[model samples]
Target chain A: MITITGLQKRFGKLAVLRGIDLNIAPGKVTAIVGPNGSGKTTLIKTLLGLVRPDSGTISLAGVSLNGDPSYREMIGYMPQAGKFPENLTVSEVLRLVKDVRRHSGPLDEALFEQFQLAESLNKPIRTLSGGTRQKLSATIAFLFRPEILILDEPTAGLDPVASAQLKDKICRERDGGRTVILTSHIMSEIEALSDILVFLQDGKVFYNGTLAAMIHSSGETRLERAIARLMEGGDAA
Target chain B: MNTTTVRIIKFEFSDVLRSKWVLIYGLFFFLLTETLFRFGGTSARVMLSLSNVVLIIVPLICIVYGTIYLYNAREFMELMLAQPLRRRSLFGGLYSGLVIPLNLSFLVGVGLPFLLHGVERTAHLQAFSMLLLAGVFLTLIFIALAFLISTAYEDKMKGLGIAILSWLLFSVAYDGVMLSLIYRFSDYPLEKAVIALTLLNPVDLARTLLLMQLDIAALMGYTGAVFELFFGSIMGAAISLAALSLWVICPMWLGLRQFRRKDF
Candidate 1:
């Protein structure tokens, strides 16, 4: 489980995360849904300790990560647009990641096979298409079976089939009692995979609950309309 | 210090070894050293001049090889940073990984041929010390400077420009400026001025130390006193080492701070 309290982050005078507080439950897929500039990425980076919040406390599994990096061991992250050195082959990249993760258990081969990365494992990362690179990033994120997986736009460049495969994998991972956090603008993806929908608007959580509760309370069958009504209304009632 | 940090260094070093560019540059450097030896004079003094050639190539190897290594490892760096590894350990590991192999290769590449030619044991020992010191100091200074530049600029070209400017300042421009100062102050007590100026550039200090070790300070005329002042006394060597150690520590400390605060 991940807990955030009084998280206030700012770049100059423009506040990105404004005293936000939330709890990310373990073994659940929590989707932070918001448009661009909604502070989703900043929130994720802060949680990962990649960015420092002006005032806040972030803890994973009851251990605070502020100014301490031990929490990174249980966390796996895949950025929105994964950038990799062009010269490294896929296998080499994996090996490099593996080298960094010394105390982790055996490699998660199931994730690799599910993504079908074996055939293209020897190819240079630069030669892989956008979809393949996303697949690679996804594979790397889940390879160590980390307790918490934070994925940013995991399906952005993936084909429909690949995206579906990844969604299924994410659901399976969550079902197996692992924490997963994802952000995507694709409504169908949110509708399909999110156990809890976190509606972020203007740097605050407007809503947080299951899709069933959101749709039932908002009096709409469509997830988009429920989100629109929630946005029309106010913060997480 | 941590095992994870050591593992990171081990893999980073392995990755650096696998680079074709690093291998190519190392080979080219070896060839250039050999060429300087083969086409030049055949006297013992010229044979000793190979030390000079070694001094020049060692620093160049340190700078170019290290700068390229950091730039090449950006992705891997990000990946590692996301892991449980400490920032200090990651940077420290990279610094060590770069220095060890290049220094070893440098020793074997130049020191081997010199020994094969049956150079005296004392001469070989001094030359070995100078070569190792030059390679180590140059590697640390440039690696620290390169880390600073890499974090200062987002673009690789800008980072490279910062690195080249730093190299130029340390390599040639600094000595030129010191000479100009020495000329203007020829009438004043210039000995201490020269001593102060020598502390500004480690590369020049290393060169003067190595050259003077071979008893070739006659090449620099009256200015050789600056070399003798630093590399001459026990006190001078201590002061020079302290100053050079600062050159390694300060920039790396600042770079790590900047990297931690960076938005990446």
Candidate 2:
């Protein structure tokens, strides 16, 4: 479980996360959705310890994440854009990450075979297309079978077939009792995967609940329209 | 110092080696050294000429390459940031990755030429070693300065500009400014003041060390007399080298502070 309380962060004069308090339970998928500049990425990055908060406490499995980075070992993060060393081959990149993680468990090559990256192991990262790069990112994020998987726009550049394969993988991970946190602009992806929806606007959480509760409260049957209605000041009573 | 840092260093070294720039830099030094030895008559004369080139060019290349590499590696750094690695190890790995290769290039480029030309046969081998040591110090000092600038500013153009300007100040413009300072205060008993000022710039400190090592203080005019009085002894040379090492450490320390607090 990941617990955060009183999380606040500001970049210069612009506040990115404003006193966010959230509890992310294990074995469930929580999708963070927000409009541009609404702090979705900032919230995720703060949770990943990439962005230090102004004042707050984040604890993973009851351990405080204050200047202690060992907690990151249990978490897997897939960045929005997978930026790797251009000179490294795909296999070399994987080796480097694995070397850093030093996990002794059985390697998970399910996604590797699903994405067919084995064929392109020798190709340099700079030559890969955007979709292929996304595949590689997803592969690394799942390689260690981390307890908490945080994926940012994981399906943004993937094809439909690859996208379906990833959704299945997410569901499988959830079934195996791992917490999954993701942020995506695609409403369908959110509807298909999220067990709970957290809507953020202007650095504040406007709605946090199950999809059914959010839809029922906002008086909109469709998930996309319900979020739009919430953004338009429709009170979630 | 641990296995992770060693792994990062190996990864980064191979990455840099593939870029071909370090190889070209090595070749540049090799060609320049060979040409200088071919035309400068004696090894002593060539060593003196090479000191001028090393003091100026090494810092310029080190700063520019260091800044650009840091900027270019920002993404790769972000990738590393998310991993289960300590920030200090990452920074240390990247720093060693860059400095080690450049130093190797310098060694192979300049060191090989000197060896092939029979530096042992020359009476000025001590001067040559001092020159090489100064070149290595300058490389480290300027690269650390570049890391400082790159980490402090988010704007790449601004960082690049400041890094180059800093090199220019140390290598070329600083001497001009100091000369005018001496000229402006010629009668003010400025010998100690000048030594203090020279210590502030690594390039000048290096030049003074090389010149004093070559025993050419008589040609350095007024400031030379002060430098000879101070840096002419073995203890003074050790002190100046320690000061140069501080120049390398201080900026790197500042850069690491910035890097630690920075949001990727």
Candidate 3:
């Protein structure tokens, strides 16, 4: 389980995450839905320790993740636009990751077979399409079966079938007693995938709970309308 | 954990070894050294001045090697940090890895030839030891500087620009400043002025040390005693080596600290 409390981050007077708090349970998919520049990526990066929090503490399983980077081993991260070395072949990049982790074999082959990455393993990353690169990233993120999976805009370049295939993989990881925190601007994807919905606006958690509760509280059936209502000040505005 | 550091260093070295850029740089350096050696026969004294030339070139290799090393290993560094390794281990590993292969190549390209046909056995051994020491000091200093610059700039071009500018300031520009100071202080005791200048510049200090070891101090006139005081006695050598080691370590510690606090 990942527990974040009073997480505050800023970039030269531009506050990104301001006094944000959230609890992510194990065996559940938590999707953070927010507008553009709403600190979705910042929050995820901070959680992964890529960005430092100015004034808050992030605890994973009762230990503070402030300085102890070893906690990251239990976490797997996929950036919004995942960047890898353009010169590296797909298989070479994965091998580097696996070698670092010393988990070279015993990878779950479901995505490997499903995405048909076997054929293109020798291709340089620069030659791969955006969708194919995303597939490679998704497979690597799930390769280790990390206790915490943080994916940012995972399906942005994915085809409809590939998107569906990835969602199925995420669901399986969650079902296998892992916590997945995914961020996407797509309302339909969040509604389909998220058990817990975190609505963020201007770097603060405006609302947090189940997707059904988010829909019902705003008196709206759709998740997007609920997010819009919550961002417009949660009935106070 | 130390082994993990070694592993990281080994991986970085191997990856860099396979890079076309690294290969190109290595070949360029080898050719540069050979050209200098082949064309540098103005006098026996000039041929003997290879030690000072090597001192200057050592840091250049370190700068180029280190700047490219960190830049190319961006993804790998991130991956390593995400693993269970400590900051010190990774750093130590990288430091040793870059130093070993680079110094070994320098020995092969420069040291062997100088030893084989050019110098006496004892002189060759002293020259080799001096080059190794110079390599260590230069590698440590430049790698730390490169790491600090790499961490400071998110843009690759900006970081490279900063690194090259830094190298210039320490190398040619620094020599210019020392020359100007000597000219300006021509009335003063020249030896004191030289000592002050060498103390101020690590590269010059290294050059002076190597020159003194090669017994070419007479070329610089009466100002040679300034270096002799620092390189003549065992105690003096120990003190100079200690100072060089400090130069190696302090910047690295600062760079590592900055990296630890860095958001990226």
Candidate 4:
């Protein structure tokens, strides 16, 4: 339920997102994969209104998001590192988010319980381990049951159990007809979770299609090999 | 003034209050004031001595603390930006969050000592109030200046360097340049020029305000007489207060503009 046209972003002389035109439909997981410095984060940041595009328009369900922050309420974003105020406790961070969102619905304590964060409620964020921090980030992202989820490397530091729990949560969200946009380096996670794949190269979309279509076109059965071949093939022509 | 703004301010203020550095800052002031009182024979002498100390230390603390806090709060700011909150509220919250606790700390640390020492009974009460007022103004002015510098650059070291340099320029170097200008233009009519120059630097403006109210024109020489003529009256005091307020507003406005347009 998002549309971006002619989106270009440049950091000084380096063009990060060059002429991007993308559409993300609802009720599906759209996995964005790319090599390092391929503007995946920049593209996501632009959609979140964190990075102002040099030239382009991003509309959410046909309404322009320029200078309007209210649209962000529909988006639940989990940043890559999940850096929080060091002094605030886990529960405090959650409470702060809940306060900001003003969500009146019954709180989703599933991820909170799954991650076993209840015991660590009083522990400061600085004291939490990296995996616990990721759990906290994951819990907050799904806490509001938002219409859309934008997760940047959501499982980067998550342990195996937490990661599986998160993967299941993503699938459940997709089944519930919620849109999810995620970026991850793990090929298997993308293959298992995403319905549509958008591969980026050098600040431009190199390939966009279903996993089956990408494999068929690349003449490779495996998703990773297909992506590698697609990178070598160029333009997906 | 929305709930989000209030929440942010509450969160930030409590977070900063819990920091040991802020406690150390308050204790530092408490100890310094107590020491000044013990050493200086008369209450008037103590107020004058504390003015110099306040002039130098308050701006330094505000600049250093403000820059460090802004840089440290980068992640928290990013988190808030992703929320459904307005940019104005976020910024307003963060600014007030920093300013309120700092103002309270100064009031408690320094004001308590003056009240306890019974400086209110003496003629130095006006000077004491002036000292506290100037301290508050300088704290705000330097904090705004720090925010401006922090927002302008991406590099933390560079931002901090510029902030410290700015504090140096206003507190120490500005006075040196002003003196040199006065000496060089001794033959020219520089009363109005000197007054204008003094207003440009918040530190100098504060010192001039306090010194004028102290009525020590003979000790201050030519610039003192000019200041007395202009700042001796209520109108001049109002003008100086306005000028100092401008120093706080102009930089903060510019910084907030930059903050709004900034890409996190």
Candidate 5:
């Protein structure tokens, strides 16, 4: 479990994360959804230690993440898959990440095989198509058997088949006792996969609970309408 | 973790090497050194000419290339930052990867011409080594300055412009300013004051060091004779080297501090 307390971050005059407090449970899929500029990505970046919070403390399993990077070992992060060392071949990039993580086991190449990345392993990342690069990102995220997975727009460039496969993979990982935190605008994706709903608005947690509870509170039958109701409530307040 | 640092260094080096910019940089130096040796006659003359080139070209290329490369690799750096790597390890690896390859290309490009031109005499060899040392020091200093600039600005055009402008400030504008200062203050006993000012500009210090090695301290052309008179040659050379080292360490230290707290 990851716990964050009073996290705050500002970019120049605009505050991105204003005193966010949250607890992410293990063995569950938590989908963070919000409107544009609602601090969803900022919250995830703080948890990933990408953005340094001005006033906050983050603890993973009771140990503080302050000034320590080794804690990231258990966390597998897949950003938008847009950036790779452009000169490196796909396989070389994979090896570099593997070397960085230094995870030892039988190795988790399940997604690698599923994606059929062998054909383009020798090509430099700059030469790969957008969807191919997306596939590579997904493969690497699952490569090390990380206890926690942070995927930012995991299916952004994926094809229909790849998207279905990835959703199944997320479910499998969640059921296998891994903590998965994802941010996506597709409410149906969250409705199908997530156990926890974290709705952020204006850098604060507007609502944090199960989707059932969220729907019940909003008096809406559907996930999209329920979130809309909550957003209206937030705007009114 | 040490192994991880090594891996990053290895990755960055290979990626940069494949780009072949270093090879082109090497070729430029090789041609310049060869042409200088052919016309300048003696090893002493060639070394002196090359020192001038080093004083101008080394810092310009190092700073420009370093800044451009840093801006291009910013995204890749974010990828690494998300990994389980410490900021220092990533930095150490990148610094080594960039500084080492650039220095090697420089050494080979210039060293070959010097060797082929038969720099076999003891004095010539010593001065040649000193020239190489100056190049290495300038490389370290300028690359660190590049990192400092690149980390401070997020826009590529802004960072590149500032980097080139900084090179101009250090290499060209600085000398112009110093010359006017001397004319304006020629009445004062400015020996110690001029020496102190030289310490502030790394390019002048490097040139002074090279001039002393060439046994033509008078060629400094700016009353650098008094700088020589301020201290013995050996002591003076050591002091200049230490100052260049400070040039490397100070900006690098500040840059690393900025990098640690960087948003990306």
Candidate 6:
């Protein structure tokens, strides 16, 4: 489990996160959903230590997020619109990450094989299509079998078949008892995969609970309508 | 320094090798040096001509290339940031990756021609070594400046523009300004002042060191005498080198501080 308290962050004069307090449970999928500029990405990046918060305490599995970076070993992060060194071939890039990892159990090639990544292994990253790059991102995120997976807009550019395959992978990972956190605009993807919905608004948490509860409490059957109601200032907490 | 940093450097170096730009850069130097040796008469005279060329070229190329490379690698840096990597390690890796390959290309590109031309005399070899040493220092100093500009500016063109402007300030404009100052204040006891001022511009520091070694301060006229009188000593030479190294370190340290705090 990951615990966060009084988390606050500001970029210059603009505050992106405001006193966020939450617990992200393990063995479940949590989807942070919000409109653009609603602090979803900032909160995620703070957890990843990509952004430093103004005030906060974040502990992963009871270990504080201090300057020491070893805790990140258990987390896998897939950036939104992942970009890589253009000239490096796919396999070389993989090798670089593996070398940086410096430790390995039996390799998790399940997603790698499922994505048919071997066929594209020799091609440089610049040559890969958007979907191919997305597939590669997903492959790497799951490759280490990390305890927590943080994926940003994972299904944005994927084809329907690839999207379904990724959704299946997310479910299987969650079933196998790893914590998964993701942010997406697609309500159906949220409804289908996530166990808990953390709705963000104006840099604050508007609602945090299950999708079914959000839908039922907001008097809307659809996740999209429920979120829309929340955005329109309907309190469903 | 750590294993992760080493791995990053290793991959980055291999990737740079495959790009072929460094090879081309080395080739350019080899051709330039060879052509100069062919046309520029005696070896000593050729070294002097090469010194002038090195003063203008090294800073220009290192600053511009380093800036563009850093800007281009921003996405790659972002990718690395999300990994289980320290910013310090990442910075070290990125820095050494470029610095090592670039310095090697420079050494081999410029060194091969002189070796082939048989600069075997010890004095000639020592002077050649000083020239090469100066080039390396200028490269180190300017690349650090480039890193500062690259990290400080978000826009590519702004970073690039500042990079070119800095090269111009150091290489071309600085001399014009200094010469004018010396002429305007020619009446004053300005030898010490000139020495102090020259130390401020890394290019001038490097040039003065080379000229002092060549014992050809006459080419610089009055101000050159001031330089020869002061920086002509062994201690002065060491001081100039230390200043040049500071030029390299200060900017890199500043750039690293910014990089550590910068948001992706």
- The best candidate in terms of TM-score: 5
Off by over 4 Å in 2: A234-237, B120-123
Look at candidate 2 and tell me the lDDT of residue A167: 97
Better of 1 and 5 by DockQ: 5
Encode model 6's per-residue lDDT on B1-264: one tens digit a residue: 798888888877886778777788788888888998899756788888888888898888889988998998987887788778898899999888888888888889899999888885677787799898998998888888888898899899999999999999988898898889988988888888887788789999898778777767777555556766765647667887888888888988998998888878
Cα deviation of B1 in candidate 3 (Å)? 5.5
* Model 3 misplacement above 4 A: A234-237, B24-47, B115-118, B189-196, B221-224, B229-235
User: Just chain B of model 6: what TM-score?
Assistant: 0.95
- lDDT tens digits, residues B31-61, model 2? 9989998998677777888888888889999
Model 5: lDDT equals 0.88
DockQ in order: 0.63, 0.78, 0.50, 0.77, 0.81, 0.68
Candidate 4 stretches with Cα past 4 Å from truth are A235-237, B120-123
Screening candidate 1 with a backbone cut-off below 3 angstroms (N, C-alpha, C), the clashing residue pairs are A206-A236
User: fnat, candidate 3?
Assistant: 0.40
Preferred candidate (TM-score higher): 2 or 4 = 2
lDDT of 6 by residue, A1-237 (tens): 999999999988999999899999999999999889989999999998888888989999999999677778898888888788888889987887777766578878887898899999999999999999998888888888899999999999999988999999999999999999999999999999999999888788879998789899989889999889888873433
* Top candidate (DockQ): 5
Which one wins by lDDT: 3 or 6? 6
A best-first ranking of the candidates according to their DockQ comes to 5, 2, 4, 6, 1, 3
lDDT by residue (tens digit), candidate 3, B1-264:
466776766766676676644456446545655565577743234345555566567677677667776777676566566555566666677767776666566656554545444654565567557765776577667777888888777888888888888888888898887778778988887776676666666676666656566665666533355667545635445656776777777778887787767775
TM-score of chain B taken alone, every candidate: 0.85, 0.96, 0.82, 0.95, 0.97, 0.95
lDDT of 2: 0.88
Ranking by TM-score: 5, 2, 6, 4, 3, 1
Q: What is the TM-score of chain A alone in each candidate?
A: 0.94, 0.97, 0.95, 0.96, 0.97, 0.97
> For residues A1-237, what per-residue lDDT tens digits would candidate 2 score against the true structure?
989899999999999888888888878999999888889999989887788789999988999887766788888888999888887899999999999889987988899999999989999998999999999999999998899999999999999999999999999999999999999999988999999998888888878899889889978888999888887783444
State every prediction's TM-score relative to the real structure.
0.89, 0.97, 0.90, 0.95, 0.98, 0.96
Candidate 1 residue spans exceeding 4 A from truth: A11-15, A103-107, A213-221, A228-237, B39-44, B47-61, B121-124, B221-223, B229-235
Structure candidate 2, residue pairs in collision: none
Using DockQ as the measure, name the better of candidate 4 and candidate 6: 4
Pairs that collide in candidate 5 are none
Residues B87-127 of candidate 5: C-alpha lDDT, one tens digit per residue: 98888888888998999999999999987878958987888
| Global CA lDDT computed for model 3 | 0.74
